[model samples]
Target chain A: MFFNLKDFIAEQSEGETDWEIDLSPLLALMVTLIPVLLLQTSFATLKMIETTLPVLSDAEQKPEEKKKDEIDFNLSLFANKKSELVMELVVDNKRLKSVTIKPDGEKFDFIKLQEELFAVKKKYPKENRLKLMPGDGVPYDIIVKLIDSSRVTPEKKPMRFVSSTGENLETTFLFPDVVFGNITN
Target chain B: MSIVHDIVKKAQKDSGFTLQLTAMVDMFTIMIVFLLKSYDTSTLEVKNVDGLVLPSSITAAAPEEAMLMLVSKKGVFLNDKRLASIVDNKIEAKSLAKEDEDFIEPLFKELNIEAEKIEAIAKRNSTVKFKGTIFMQADKGLDYSVLRKVMYTATMAGYGDLRLAALDGEK
Candidate 1:
């Protein structure tokens, strides 16, 4: 037999070398699918900022209970009509500290507000609730920005705190509990 | 001159090579798979209103299932039902309750009726209880005065837990 390995291999491989794969259906499918997916795709995700509102109570009125040694910080923020943001820190039903953030050039200073909140958080690491009182003339967007500034740090890192159960916990939550106030007379 | 002419002629000729679609198809498949996987229906979609622009927030709280309330510049709606009409950036005088100017009569009545229905259902089903949670999508342009009125009315109607809906975006 006068057989050459190169010729035999070449002859065997040549059968499939010229065959073309059909890509028209796949191209058409991708073209059709991309538009539909693009139309269905929601670019922005939705989130929620949970807040507790004051409710009517039917329980008998009782005097508030205060511990002798413990000084719990009850933080409250008020945005007045003049765009003046006032942060009042009350401890055991007594006004402890008041920090005011002034507006600069027709815009409320949100960065200054966040810095103050960060400072307060550093001093009182366990305090969790913030009473947001958006007074008249403050826009809804600014209120939302204030809430964001009060809740999160610029770096968006978790802060550590000791829980009521004495367990050490790390959380991204800063003043996560928001109580809406300043609505009643 | 001959060499230049030859090069020009060679450049003009078609190579006849088919486009390499395998890699493109592979990329498309990956993209399609990712898009399909991310198609979540658990979170409620905030509808696109004519004059409503939701504020942006960095809050990581995922939106839960609750009664949806939309407070746009045009009106306040409850689950796509128009309850109050706002004109000139304020709620119309006719819609406000006589007893309390801050109270929206229509919204309060509707919320009360819904509360009744929910309470009735909750009686038989011990697992489900009326927690009074409302997911509110309010416009960014509206004033805090308007929001105060709505929130007051909601509290009166027994829906005290308010969850403000917002677009999740960068600071």
Candidate 2:
């Protein structure tokens, strides 16, 4: 025979197993994919900032709630266009102490506000209602931060104090009951 | 010396060899799975709207599901519908249906229509009440003026619950 039988068989079998597949395309794909996937990954948690409670329907509202609106929750803060935070305390709907917190340059002093709030919480530990009157052109984040400062202590913990009834209470929030005074404005 | 020579000879033998892909394939599979699993897919698949950035909050409260409203620098969207255009961080005056600066007419009308739909459904279905809750997603840099307009219109349309969307951040 002109052709060698063993060599022919060896040549046919060699093509079957020892094949090294080109991995450059796969490598390219992986190189492109890893960064994309990593870029798309998010470590941050999406949260919701709870504003004032929803208005209940007339039929769903309690008599106390309806009358509660008429009752003065005398604690209020006004964020003027100059970004000054004016905290006002009213008793019997009469003008009481109006603490004006002016901003240093452009930034409102939230830390000072928090400290002031600590004092306010000490006096009216049971009062949780706060009327917020934010200015027209103020940034939304400032208002949110202001709410946070008003509701919690400077340490981000709940405000702690004793009640008006001489009961020892701790971890009570400052003023979570916030009413947007400028919502209609 | 013979063993060394044999090893050298084997190195010069057949160059063709199959890649051990099982280990690499396994690694890639694990990586892909991990990356895909890490993606956040909870609480109203709220996506990143262009020009809108959410501020981080110290509060750990989780987001709730409701009507989605997105306010970017470019425009104002309600449930993914563009209701008004914003110019210079404020909604365009032309977008206002009424002369009132606080009222965005298109937004009000759409919200009214949505309120009517919910109310109509509530009339027959006692279980489903119109809980006028709006899940607001506004840019951190946006002015309170613009947001107040939207809020005012929403309240007028009978949706009073305003939940501002924020990113859960470090304490």
Candidate 3:
């Protein structure tokens, strides 16, 4: 009976007319909004994810420390028929030290060169890396042996080949400068 | 009146708003997804300087963004501007000397300016962080000593990251 009264009785105030509430349009509106809301929400979520990617932090160092780190000490080994081996430590274009390794017939004395190299290592206590540039005509096996000799101490760095094409060819950061030359047919 | 009420109810029930937008929303979603996926995160690929013959290398690598420093049979160029004559198995020091200032120092100053500008732009936009790889497109017949000095000069001018340009896939 109370439900009937509420349904039947129409209250009139300030010239208002009785009307039934229609939910169909509201339902349609909500249905339309679902996909838009989903899209916007997904876009916002993806944008947030992209922004949250971690950036690598650079190692902090003082100017003096950086300068010390940038001191490029390179040892260039030039082999000729006369001397057999000419080892020169080129510190920024100027030769800081040099040594001549004479071939003792069939045997090469690498241990003596290693001892001398160790002495030079103590000189530049900071960033004691020595980039090695071996000239052409040096045997492959000899180059490998020199590499082993250069690695006598953990402090002693490997060599890098200085090719005309500026490329870091080595997979590992050692043996700095090795020019790749073509074999003549 | 009952017929009119039925028509009104049907009209309200079938507003067509949701129906119209369903397909549009799907299309937009797919477009957005593809746009996000296909976007290249890397900066502009630097092209090697044209007309300059680069020394061939089996071990040379492809550089990222690079600044073109063309070394031709005629002269040394920093992106079209002639810097010096490379001849006689050596970089003629006389060729590098200007009115009073030295050639290498002036060249250094110019290169530094370019590098600083690039660095500044990179600072604001990280997508272009690699300022300029010094692309030494030196010719094959060029003197080795000249090439060596060019390498040294470019490296000393705050453009140490060197790149020798070459024909792709050619040894």
Candidate 4:
């Protein structure tokens, strides 16, 4: 067989034209990014709650005569040091009852707090606003848990409410509107 | 006769080994899909700082782009810049009460600058509106007083809409 260098070069060039690009670098990049993205995936699940600072205004104060017939269902919760949770029910700017919840072992008794709040929810089905006034020393996690407890009834103990269609439905909406307030002792 | 038999046996053996990559490729494919699915691009970018573990919540709304303030046990930060140290879950009482008169000076200054910048941008661009919002990320262990001070400073700086950042609880 006669070896033709020109023809061999031409054939090699033609074969090169059909060659596939190496995707190994791209694959390596993807492999490297997967773990980084996985670590960052938690930020995607980040959530937020809209809160406003409690404003003090003279307009909020009204004469006692005007509010005689109006029943305010707003509940106030105070978490103090020594793991004590004080709950107060305010009706027409009057304190109805103040209940203090102590810790169960090493943790605050959230179940008891939920039960108390649930009772209030049952009494005032239309009232949804709650004021959580955490003491200066109370940790933020406890406040978040308190908010969680006040906002909804736990799944384990789902409350039953009659729907507009007259069908009884299990719901978790206890007090969705929460106003963060200063601890006024 | 023995040598000829050995040669025939050698000739009958398979030639080479082949590696199957189908299973590996499938694994990588699934991994890529899972990673992509878990990556959330809609939420605001948050970097984990030391001593700042976000509390978990069941809410699902994404945060808007706004001034970022981080309150941790170690210190208070505005957009990653340390403004003040937290002692006993409170910013230096002197600075808040007398020096700044119930306002965190550094945080207030930073937030005021940001609010003014946003206001300027809104003035030039008719479509842009200053929402006066701040995205606050505080450590789960921080006291409410610290959060209150930070939030109050932010509100005074004209960022009234406070969006508290938290981790999404497992549903």
Residue pairs clashing in model 1 are none
Residue A163, candidate 2: Cα error in Å is 4.2
For this target, which candidate reaches the highest TM-score against the unseen true structure? 1
Distance (Å) between predicted and true CA of B74, model 1? Answer: 0.9
Residue B10 lDDT (model 4): 50
Chain A TM-score across all models, in listed order: 0.73, 0.63, 0.41, 0.65
- For A7-118, candidate 3 gives per-residue lDDT tens digits of 4444433336634455444445444655555543321110100001111235675565436446556765554423266567777778888888787675556656666665
In model 3, which runs have C-alpha deviations exceeding 4 angstroms? A1-75, A79-185, B1-53, B92-94, B97-106, B123-127, B130-132, B166-171
How much lDDT does each candidate structure score? 0.81, 0.76, 0.48, 0.74
Query: Which candidate gets the maximum lDDT versus the true structure?
Result: 1
lDDT digits (tens) for residues B1-171 of candidate 2: 344334434554655444455566567767877888766556564467888988777753788778888999899998789989998987988887666778889998888888889899999999988888888888889888888888888877778777888876563
TM-score of each: 0.81, 0.74, 0.38, 0.75
Report the lDDT tens digits of candidate 1 across residue range B39-153: 6566588688988999988864889999999999999999789999988678998889988899999999999899999999999999888988999999998988888888998
Residue by residue across B10-121, what tens digits does model 4's lDDT show?
5544543233334554677788888777777664765668788888886435676766778888898877788888887768865564754457887878877877888899
Error of 3 at B152 (Å): 3.3
Taken in order, the candidates have interface RMSDs of 9.0, 8.9, 17.4, 10.2
Which residue ranges in model 1 land beyond 4 Å of their true spot?
Answer: A1-12, A15-17, A20-39, A59-72, A157-173, B1-27, B30-34
- Residue pairs with clashing backbones, model 4: none
Write the number of the candidate with greater lDDT, choosing between 3 and 4.
Answer: 4
